[model samples]
Target chain A: MDAESTAASKGALVDLDEATCWSLLGPAGIGRLSWTSGGKPFVVPVNYRVSDGRLEVVTAAYSAIARECDDAFVALEADSTDAEHHAGWSVLVQGTAAIDFQHPSSDGPRPWPAGVRRQLLVITPASVTGRRLT
Target chain B: MDAESTAASKGALVDLDEATCWSLLGPAGIGRLSWTSGGKPFVVPVNYRVSDGRLEVVTAAYSAIARECDDAFVALEADSTDAEHHAGWSVLVQGTAAIDFQHPSSDGPRPWPAGVRRQLLVITPASVTGRRLT
Candidate 1:
């Protein structure tokens, strides 16, 4: 809760500031995208890039994520861990997703396992919050 | 979507078999839980353990996860990656959640951030699926 790392022990979750949260979001490069469809919640890992506060990701037209997430409210999360020390940090963004066809293909890194990533999903983050396990 | 890793070039998503999916989920101990409340999606990082196909997790009673997830449909994911190789695997479990007061505390590891984790949530996975970026 406190910004001071001293107040937190290993594995203690500390609430992160907005600035720190966004800073973490940038370098993580990849994260999980969570969305709901037909009353079932689904979390899919995505190759993403954050630029100007918007999260950009590429998904196949037939992938579950693209099928369920476009034009829907979704959550994107990225995190890192120091497994040896049992510590880590996670950033979660709650936002609305839409197909950004106009987004240039060069905007971010393409999804791995290269395929027809015809749909470009952009999540305009409405709230960004994070926590660090120190 | 083929199971053959070769057919899936780097970034091409390959659908994973059920057995492989569970295997990957076990070693990847931490993942994001995606849930919906008030029609908005929330994804929170959780330290989880898998036993006999059940996903067991602990959450602070006062935290957002416990408040919105009990007795709800939720998804738990676990995965791993070789960042240098630009390849990874992700597993998703869609299931129902309930407050398992009778669940033995000995069932799984305690939540990080030593605090009041008053709720024990058990998700009886209805569907288990996965994909690998090979």
Candidate 2:
């Protein structure tokens, strides 16, 4: 579509549907995940790939973030806004997290990329919801 | 203005200026605050008010969030999205936090509402930035 036509077609507010949210999270490679560990609040930006409708990321072992985040309540979020698209949207997924603690060499998926030493943290969302701007 | 004119006037994307972000955070009263403690992550939904370019909220003394967050890095976030306006925005303020640690008898601001105890946790944002969707 041309720029003018796209601008004309854009809406001012958008209440995103569940399908749209799923699509956005599935294809996006980045988002912030918030959780509670050791009774304190924490947020980390991760390069993540969504799988099974959940957020997945890798972390180093024995680190502060890993140490605190065993069995936690996690929230994931994504949004966008720009000049040509005076609109944006955000989705939040709140869920429980667990470590794929099994060693990577045997049965389960290869959990880490280069420079990733700790176990994998998978956020299995209990409630996934989102909102959009028109 | 009529609906059509307003619609036409709306931009597709908006690169929000600092003034706009300040305005949005200032008037709004709700956001999520994240922090780390004892090697774990934690997050709490708060009813906050911005004061002196920082985010302020109340908490009880001896709380888990209070004990772990001493001299910690905290993040505060706010965003909005809708259908009539297909746009949204997100602002992140990262900073150090501290408790007022004082009783609310004679000197400082009365820190809590009804059902609020403990001291105050004020997030003095070291870096404040935001993005908008057009």
Candidate 3:
């Protein structure tokens, strides 16, 4: 699109509410997960689910991420924009992370949501913050 | 926009090229900078510039990021979508980070692109990877 066209199509802004924010992430199968490795930060894209006000994600136990979680703070964020770029909201959750090794491991007909995975990254929020771009 | 409209307007995909990836970020003032804090991960939005094949971002010396950069790796990424959602590209740089203590400290005219501030997050990527969504 041309600069003029792009500027003219900025679109209408949508007001953000708790319901809207929840809706944006409820079905978004993908989100970015960030963590620190040896002091610097690393961000990895992963499939996630929101359950009980926190994000529950599964990863391979032998993944580099699991090997590096040395009892430090971590966060997860998800965002999406509409066709007009008029409305979008971002939810950020900050909290402690742990490996839920006891998580179920099964791939039956009715798999548990994100499949039966042996490893789980459980994020317990110390703070839940969100923002909407209007 | 309704779900049907959103799906119908996925737009025409754009061909990927190195020049296109560079151009998308060269002018976009905002990008996401991710790093590890403690043992978890954090993603922060900041205004950045593409300079010398690496991402140069500035922050306060006392910023939590600065304190946490205790000899570790870091990464920076930028992405943008067009009106049609048909084309976009993302550039990710992974590298070692160091503080440029002697970085120019000034707000003078043409102040070195991203302004002269207290701290600099110099991401010298061991691997610079990029992807384009067409």
Candidate 2 vs candidate 3: which has greater TM-score?
A: 3
Q: Score the docking of each candidate (DockQ).
A: 0.51, 0.09, 0.19
Cα-based RMSD of the predictions, in order?
A: 4.8, 15.5, 10.0
TM-score of each: 0.87, 0.48, 0.55
Candidate 3 CA-lDDT value: 0.57
Which candidate model has the greater lDDT, 1 or 2?
1
Model 1 over residues A25-114: C-alpha lDDT tens digits? Answer: 875387888887887777877888776778888876787777788899999888887767777899889999988778665456567767
Q: Report model 3's chain A TM-score.
A: 0.69
Ranking by DockQ: 1, 3, 2
Candidate 2 accuracy as lDDT: 0.60
Clashes of each: 8, 56, 11
Query: Model 2 over residues B1-134: C-alpha lDDT tens digits?
Result: 55456446553444566777788787545566677544433454455777767677766566655775557778777765443544566676777888777635232322222223446777888777766656
DockQ of 2: 0.09
Across B43-95, the per-residue lDDT of candidate 1 in tens digits comes to 88788878667888887667787788888999988888778888888888888
Off by over 4 Å in 3: A1-24, A70-72, A81-87, A107-117, B1-31, B36-40, B46-49, B56-73, B78-92, B96-134
What 10-residue stretch in candidate 3 chain B is worst by lDDT? Answer: B107-116
Model 2 lDDT at residue A31: 62
